[model samples]
Target: AVVSFTGVAVAVVSFTSIGVAVVSFSDGSVTVVSFSGVPVAVSFSRISVVAVSFNDIAVVVVSFASIGVAVVSFSDGSV
Candidate 1:
C-alpha cells in the first residue's frame, strides 16, 4: 500500500510468504523489515547497504552520505 502525506510518497509492503517486508521512502531510501525470520536491512543513497542475519530482531541500518557508509548489526539482540 502507498500513502502520500505532506507530498512525500511512502510505500509499504506486507510480509510475503518468503518472509520479507519492504518499506520505501521518497528520499531514495529502502527498508527491509524481514528475511525469512531474519532481521531487517536498510539502504540509503550515496551510502551503503546493510544485511542482518543469524539472529532474531537483529536490524541492520545503513546510511550513505558524501560517499561515506555506515552499518549496524546485532547478534542475539545484544552486541
Candidate 2:
C-alpha cells in the first residue's frame, strides 16, 4: 500500500513467503528491512536505503539539509 501524506509517502508491504525486504527513496538511496517479513519505508526530503542481507539488517536515516547520517545495523556477524 502506498500512502501519500502531503508531499511525502509511506509504503507498506506484507509477505507470506521467505524473502528479503528492501526500501528505496527517490533521492539516491536504498534500504532493506526484513527477510521474509513485512517492510516499511518512509520518505522525507532525502533518500534512504535499508537492506537486509543474510541475518543482518541495516537502517539509515538521512536529512536533506542536515550534515549527519544515522546508520544502525544488526546482524549475526555474517554480513
Candidate 3:
C-alpha cells in the first residue's frame, strides 16, 4: 500500500507467511520491522530521524521542514 501527502510518501509491504514487514518513506529511508521472525532493520537519511525495532515491533518518526512529523508503527506480537 502507498500513502502520500503533498511532498511525502509512505509505503508498506508485508509477508504474513514469513512474518516480514517493510515500511518506506519518500526520502530514501526504509524501515523493516521484522523479517522471517528475525529482528528489525531501519535505514534513513537527512536529519532528525528516529527508528526503533524490537521483536515484531517497528516504529519510525521523522521531522523536516514542510514535511512535518511522521510516525509509523508495525507489530503483531508474534515471534
Candidate 4:
C-alpha cells in the first residue's frame, strides 16, 4: 500500500490493481474512487453520515454505507 499523508488536510492511499481513497480534512467531506481513469464512485460525507453514489448520472446518490466494505453504489449505477 502506498500511502502519502501530505499533511493534516489531505491524505492519499493507492494500491496497484485496487482503487484509490482520498480524504479531505475540510468541513465538507468528499471521497472519490476511480478505475482506469474513470470515476466510478463518490462519497459525500456529512458528519457521521456518508452518502455513497455512482456515475455522474446519479452524479448519482441512492445508498447508505460506511468507511469499511460496503455495497457501495457504483457511479455507473451498477449497485
Candidate 5:
C-alpha cells in the first residue's frame, strides 16, 4: 500500500506487500494492515481516517472522516 500526503498535515503507513495508507489535513489519521497474508497497497491523501484489512487472496480499502483513504492487498497460497 502506498500513501502520500502534502499539505498542512500528513500521515502515511506502508505494509510492503501488505498494504499502504496515507492521510493529510489539519489533522489526519491513517491505518494499514495485512492479516494472515501479504497485502498490496492502501493509499490516502488529505484524509482523516484510513483503515484496511487483508487476508489470503483479498484486498480491502476503507476511508473515514472528512478526508480519508485506505487500500489493502493480500495473497495466500489459496483463498
Candidate 6:
C-alpha cells in the first residue's frame, strides 16, 4: 500500500511474516519494519537554503514497536 500527500508520501508493505512501512515529507522520510517478529522504525531529513529565505523542517514518528529512530538536518548560508 502507498499513500502520498501534496508534499509528503507514505508506503507500506507486508510479505509472508515481515512488514515494512515508509513515510516521506518535503524535507524528510521515515521507514518502519517488522522483521522476525521484531518491529523497527527509522526516519531522516535534510534541508538547505540560501539568501533571505526561511527554512523549517520537522519530523514526528509514532509507533508501538521495538525500535524507532529519527534524523534531521538543516543548513542556511546567506550574505
RMSD of 5: 7.8
TM-score of 2: 0.29
Clashing pairs in 4: 54-74, 54-75, 55-75, 55-76
Better structure of 1 and 6 per TM-score: 1
Residues 12-49, candidate 3: write the lDDT tens digits: 44434445555556666666555444343344443244
Model 6, CA-based lDDT = 0.27
Locate the minimum summed-lDDT window of 10 residues in model 6: 48-57
lDDT of 2 at 68: 43
For candidate 2, the lDDT comes to 0.39
CA-lDDT, candidates in order? 0.47, 0.39, 0.47, 0.33, 0.39, 0.27
* Model 4 Cα RMSD, 1 decimal: 11.8
Summed over model 2, clashes come to 9
lDDT, model 4, position 40: 50
lDDT of 2 by residue, 1-79 (tens): 2223344434332222344444444444555455533344455455454433333343222332243434433333221
Residue range with the least summed lDDT across 10 consecutive positions in model 3 = 38-47
RMSD of 1: 7.4
Tell me the deviation in Å of residue 75 in model 6: 39
Candidates in order, TM-scores: namely: 0.36, 0.29, 0.39, 0.22, 0.28, 0.28
Q: What is the lDDT of residue 58 in candidate 2?
A: 34
lDDT of 1 at 22: 61
Give the residue spans of candidate 2 off by over 4 A: 9-17, 36-79
Q: What stretches of model 4 exceed 4 Å from their correct place?
A: 1-8, 12-17, 37-79
Model 3 / residue 36 / CA error / Å: 6.8
lDDT assessment of candidate 4: 0.33
Per residue, candidate 5 scores C-alpha lDDT tens digits across 1-79 of 3344554343333334544332333354534343445433444443333243443234444343344444332333221
Candidate achieving higher lDDT, 5 or 6: 5
- Overall local distance difference test of candidate 3: 0.47
